[model samples]
Target chain A: MKEVFTMWKNTKMVVLTAICGAVYAAVLIPFKPIPLIPGFTEIRPASVLPVVFSLFFGPAGAWGSAFGNLIGDFFGTLGIGSIFGFFGNFLYGYLPCKVWSYLSPQTEPLINHPALWLKYIFTVLIASLGCAIPISWGIDWVGLIPFSVLANIIFLNNFFVSLILGPILLFTLYPRFKKWNLLYSQIGEITSEKTFLQNIGFIFILIGCFGGLLVGNLTSLGHFTGKIGINLIPLIFSLILGTILI
Target chain B: MSIYLYLERNTFIHRLHPVTKIFLLLLFFILLLLFSSPLPIILVTFFLLLVSAFSRSISNLRKIWKLMFILFTFTIILWTIFLKNLNYALAMALRLNALIFTGLIFLSVTRIEEFTYGLNKLGLPFRVSFALTLAFRLVPSFILSAQTTIQAQKSRGLDLETGNLVQRIKKFIPLLIPILATSLRNAELLAIALECKGFGIKKKRTSYLDYKFGRNDFLTLLTIFLLYFLLLKIF
Candidate 1:
C-alpha cells in the first residue's frame, strides 16, 4: 500500500503507470459504442488489463487502472458515479497483486500447474468482486441503478473477462517482462511476509465483499424486506477497512 | 480514434480558470444530486443546456448524442419495468443526461493540460499530474496501434464478428498480445527517456501554461454559490 504512493517518486514507475493507463483506456474507449447495458456496464475486454497489469506492474498498475477508467469515463460516462468507479478500478488492480503475493509468493504467475491455476482463478474472483461491490453500492446509493442489477453485471463482466484472458496474457507476457527486468518485483520492493493482522483483514474482505454482494442482491430483489441502504453501511465500512489493512 | 472532446473556442465558460472549471463541474454534480424530482431535474437539464449553448460546445454534444439517447431511453425503460414508476423513471433519466452533459461541457472547454494543472493546483502531486497528462497524450497513439493490430489479425483470417459473445471476446486475445508487447516495449523506452531528461530531480516543476483568477472566474464562483444557497433555502 505504501508502495502505491512511493512508486510515484520513481520515474520508471510513473512511466509504467501512464503506459498502463493509456493502454487500458485505449482498449476501453473503442468498446464504448457497444454497451451490454446502456449507460451502465459494457463489454469490457479491457477489464483483463488490470488483473494482468497488477501481477506485472504492481501499485503502478493499480493507479493506472484507476486513472485509466477515469479517462474512459471522460468519453461519456463521467458523472458523480465516476468517483466510485475510480476507487473500484483501483481495487480491481490492487487486490490481485496483493492477494497473489499472499497466496503464492516468489512464484511465476504462469498457469502451468493446476494448483497455481486455481490460485490465479481465486485471485481474479476476489479482484472482480472487489471492483463490483463498491461500484454497485455507490451507483445504487446514488439511485441511478439497483444494487442487484449492477452488482451482478459488474461481477460477471469482470470475472469472466479476467478469468479467461488473464492467464493467457500472463503466460505470454510474464517472461518478456521478466527478461526485460520490468516485472514489479524487479522494479519495486518485494512484498514482505503476511502479518497476522493482514490475514484477519483478508477474512474481513471475503466476508464484506461476498456478504455485500449477496445482501445487496437479496435486498434489492425483494427477497429481503429491509432497506439495503441501512444494511450496506457496515459492509462498506468493512470493505474499506479491509483494503487499508491488506 | 480521436476521443478528446475539448473544443477550441473563446467563450465565457472557456475563459474561466481551470480550477474554477473543476469547481463548476463539482457544483453541477451536487446540484443534480440535490434535485432528484422530475421538475427540478428538468430545470437543471434546461440550465445545463443553456450553459452548453453559452459555451458554444453544444456541437460537441452531438458526438455523443447517440449514447445519450440510448442511455436515456434504457434508464427509463429499466426503471419503469423494475419500479413501475413513470415519474421516477423520467427523473432518473434526466439526471443521468444532465450529468453527462455537464461532463461533456467540462471536457469540451478544458484541455488535458489544463485539467492536470488544475488538479495540481488542487494539491495533487506533480508526478501524478504528469502521469495523467502523459496518459492522455498516449491514449490515442495506443488506440491507433491497437487498431493496426486488429487489422493485422483480421488480415490473417481471424474472425472477430461472426462468433458467439464469449468466442468473440476470446478472439480478442490475438489482438491483445501484440498490443501489450509493443506497449510494454514503448513503456521501457519512455521510462528511460524520462529518466535521462531528469524528470524527478526538482521538487518544484514549472509549466508552460499559466492560469490566473480573472474577473470572469470570480463572477462564475459567486453566481454558483448564490444559486446553491438559493436552492438550499428553497429545497
Candidate 2:
C-alpha cells in the first residue's frame, strides 16, 4: 500500500491527467448527440486523458484512464444509464486506445512487421464489438434506449468513429507524456501517428463495417423474432450494406 | 477506507481476474434483461445481492445508496403523476435497483490494479494498461487540486456560493478557465514524461505484475457457469 502511494508521490502528472479527463468530460456535456444519428450518438471521443495516462504511467495508467472516464461520465453525463457508464465508456474509450498502443512501436517488439498495422485494425474492430456487447447490455437494461432491440441496433454505431478517434488521441498524447526510460527507445519520435496510421485508418473503417455486420447478424439471429423474415432480412441487409460502405 | 464504500476483505470477486469479471458482468447484465417480470428477477436479484455480500463487496451498497434514492424518488414522482399505478412503479424501481447494485458490487470489490494486470495478461499492451494506472493515480490528485483551487479563489473574495442557478454556473466558469488552463499545461508535461520514457520503442512491453489463473479463478468460473444457467432458465 505504501509502495503504491510512494510510487505516485509528487506525480503531478497523474493528478493533472485525471483533471484533464474530468475537464474534457465537463466541456463535452453540451455536445452530446440528440439520438438523431442512429449510430453516431456520442458527443466526443475524448481519448486524450486516457491516451495520456497510458503513455506516461503504463498499464496501470490505462486502467486509471477508464476509471477517469467513468468519473467523467458520472459528473458530466449522468443519465438513467449512469450505472452502466463505467462499462460503456471504459470499453468505448480505453479498450480500443490500449489495443492501438500495443501495436505501436512503443510496445515491446511483438509483431514488428509494418503489415501488422492492418491486423491492428482488426484488433480494434474486435475490441469495439467486444466492449460494445457489454455496454449495449447495460444501456439496454437501464432503459436508456426504449427497447433493447433499438439499443443493440445502435450499440456499435460509433465503432468506426472511435477507431479513428482513438489512434489520433494515442498519436497526439503519447509523445508528449511518455516516460524517460521508454522514450529512449523511440528517441526521435514525437507522436504515434505516421504513414502507418493512414493505412491503418482505412483498414479500420473496413473492419468496423465487417465487425458491425457480424455482430448485427449474430444478435438478430439469436433474437426471438417469430415472424419468418421480419427480423432476419433487414438485419442482414443493414449489416451487409453497412459493411460494404463502412 | 469505508467498508460500506469499498469491500474490505479479499474474496472470489476481490480475487478473480478483472477481465473475467468484465466478461461475467456483460453476461450477467444481458441475462438480467431477458425478463420483464419481477418475480424471478426479484429472486435472482436477491441471490445476486447475497453473492455480492459473500464476495465481501457489501461496501458497494453504501456508495449506491444515493443513486438508489434518486431513482426511487424519481419513480415515485413520475408514477404519482402519470401512471397512477403504484405496482408498476415499484416494480420498475426494484428492477433498476437490482441492476445498479449489481454494478456497484462489481466495482467496489475489484481493485483497478487487478483489472489492469488482467488486461495486460490477457494480451492488452503494457502502455495502454499503464495509461489506466496513471488515470487512477491522478483522480485523487485532481480532486485535491480542485479543492485547493476553490479555496484559493474563495480566499480572494470570489462569490462562488452566492448566486442564482445560471449566475452560480456562470461564476464557476471563470474559476474553471484557470483550472482547465492548468490541466492542459499539466497534460503537456505528462505527455513529455511519457516521451522521456521509451514508450513506443518496442512492439511489446512487460507488465510489472503478472496475472494468472488459480483456485480463486476456478471458483469464479464455476460461479459464472452457475449464474449463466440460472439466468438462462429465468430468461
- Indicate which candidate wins on TM-score: 1
Q: Give lDDT for model 1.
A: 0.86
Best by DockQ: 1
TM-score of each: 0.96, 0.55
- What local distance difference test score does each model get? 0.86, 0.49
lDDT of 2 by residue, B37-136 (tens): 5675687688777877688766556655775777666654444443466665666666667766666766666666775677676786555456555654
Query: What docking grade does candidate 2 earn?
Result: incorrect
Per-residue lDDT over A6-93 for candidate 1, one digit per residue giving the tens place of the 0 to 100 score: 8998888998899999999998865433356446666788989999999999999999999999999878778988998999999999
lDDT per residue for candidate 2 within A1-246, as digits (tens), equals: 122223332234344435445554443332233233333233233333333333344333433444555555433132335544454444344333335443464563223356654754554554455344444444433433222343343344444433444444445434443432332233222235445544554355444434444544454344543422233334334322322221
Clashes of each: 0, 60
TM-score of candidate 1 to 2 decimals: 0.96
Quote model 1's iRMS. Answer: 1.6
DockQ of each: 0.69, 0.08
Instruction: Give the i-RMS of model 2 in Å.
Output: 9.3
Model 2: share of true interface contacts reproduced: 0.09
TM-score of chain A of each: 0.94, 0.51
Candidate 2 Cα errors over 4 Å, as ranges: A1-19, A22-68, A72-246, B1-8, B76-88, B121-125, B161-165
